[model samples]
Target: MKATTVQNTFDDITLWNKMREGDEKSFSILFKRYYDDLVSYGNSLSPDKEKVQDCVQDVFIDVWNYKEKVQSAVVVKAYLLSSVRKRIARLYQRDHIFRKSTSIDAVSFHMEFSVEHELIDDDYATKQKVLHLNNLLNNLPARQKEALYLRYHQGLAVEQIAEMLDINYQSASNLVYRALITLRKEWKGALSLITLLSSGSF
Candidate 1:
């Protein structure tokens, strides 16, 4: 892992220890830190903010209750996301949310670039063409786009994404591969053009 990743892991470990030791302040700090991220992810699963909030609240409450018994997570954020997704899935099952919407009403979402800043720099022409590239990305089928977003934007492992998306390891791995194949096939020429232009070779 990179230094930042190692640091974050250590921080989470410290926070987990504090929370386990009955430190109310640490509990509040942890809650405040991840609440917005949880809310955003919840809203993504369903646009109903009220329902999302309820699910997030419930997940946290459960977390607090089970904090003593909960195994120390390797990636705390991914574990939280997985919990939120499972909670929402259960809600959908109870409310029959899928039955309410036909296939035609399916919502399309692009990745929100949660980890985008680390990959961007002023010098990269690719940054300038993001809007166009995202448009091209929209051409991909929904599941393919989702898999790509989870892999690249969210920085999730295949196992974590598979658990969150409720798919098998092989399916998640293949999904990323297929999405990359399509993206590279479509975007290769554009990237080469940018490179050539930047080099004043045109």
Candidate 2:
């Protein structure tokens, strides 16, 4: 899992509570859990990796400084993600005028997946199929791809995705629905092709 959502699931309630109670260890754990994800998400908005890193660090700093005042979060991970986005945008506004402005709402999302080890066997054909599917997934529109990733990978519900993306509930549902429709349309044929290739029917 490259730059994956580090939490096994969004059940960060315990971690959040600990962090709020002045537990540095728990805070570190939470920061590690979301650090890579925040960097990746920040990269989606701007090419400046350094700026993204600064913003991510700043967000955690703020977390520490104001932890006592923090309220309980049903989805702590979503809150962190939103903070990263908003922080990056604000930094962009304060620092410089980018040709492509860094607006969280206008983030151009992209996802990258790791090919499984089975697909990395000595079989060259299987590798190609995996690569093809990888390409297809990478090509999905930012929002649609984000919807699918949150739904399938992070195990987040549509409501959580809506809040993270700052979109309406129906919009999030439709976005995910459309992505599934697109993937389902190609899924069978892609699987069949992989099967046929695996069987050496090429």
Candidate 3:
């Protein structure tokens, strides 16, 4: 019999299922696929890059160790993201400095947005607008910033975000909606820029 190969083109759920069946190639593919995204999301939650990286690694390790016992996830990306968040929270709990912060909600999110200069026009006015937009995004409340990041950057649905953040659907929707409303209120003339940002053009 020919050896089976795992293709990167396979959807996450398919890879996840293969992994559960002890397919190392599928597991490796899944890891390489989401590792960077997981690291980026982990860094947003905790500034300690080493700790975040460790937590992300531990998440994969745990999954592999208990692959037979773990249930299949409807959305593999969301599941991995939620696992990273919980792992980081547990790590924080073990640290004396963050002992009081037991919940992921208490963790501050540090999300920053930047537009590549080459991606936009070279005019000074457009540059200033981009800077202003980045400033506004970085100033949003932690929860709002996180919500927007999941929705816009990760392409996660509101319900998936709610589950990942442990919030209700309406709250998740409101977080995104209010974030956009606040941006529009503060930068009324930048609607097109906002649309581009939401569309992940940046």
Regions of model 2 farther than 4 Å from truth = 1-11, 95-102, 113-129, 189-202
Total residue pair clashes for candidate 2: 0
Best by TM-score: 3
Q: lDDT tens string, model 3, 1-202?
A: 3333334468889989999999998899888889999999999888899999999999999999999988986788888998999888877778846445577777667868664556556678877876787788788898998898888788889999998888899999999998988776655343375554665422
- State residue 199's C-alpha deviation in candidate 1, in Å: 24
Better of 1 and 2 by TM-score: 2
Give me the runs in candidate 1 sitting further than 4 Å from their true place. 1-10, 97-129, 189-202
In TM-score terms, candidate 1 sits at 0.70
TM-score of each: 0.70, 0.75, 0.88
The C-alpha lDDT values of all candidates are 0.64, 0.71, 0.81
| Clash tally, candidates in order | 0, 0, 0
Query: Which candidate has the top score in lDDT?
Result: 3
Q: Kindly list the per-residue Cα lDDT of model 2 for residues 1-202, writing each as its tens digit.
A: 5433534543589878888899887788788888987787777666888988998999999989999998876688777877887887677666657566656576666545444535355667766655675666667788887777667655578998898788899999998888767655654433443332223200
Candidate 3, position 46, lDDT: 86
What is the per-residue lDDT of model 1 for residues 1-202, given as tens digits with 9 covering 90 to 100? Answer: 7644533554666777677677666666667667887787677667689998999889878878878877766577777777887787677666766576322113334333321323444646656555445555666676666666666545688998787677799998998887667655645433442332222200
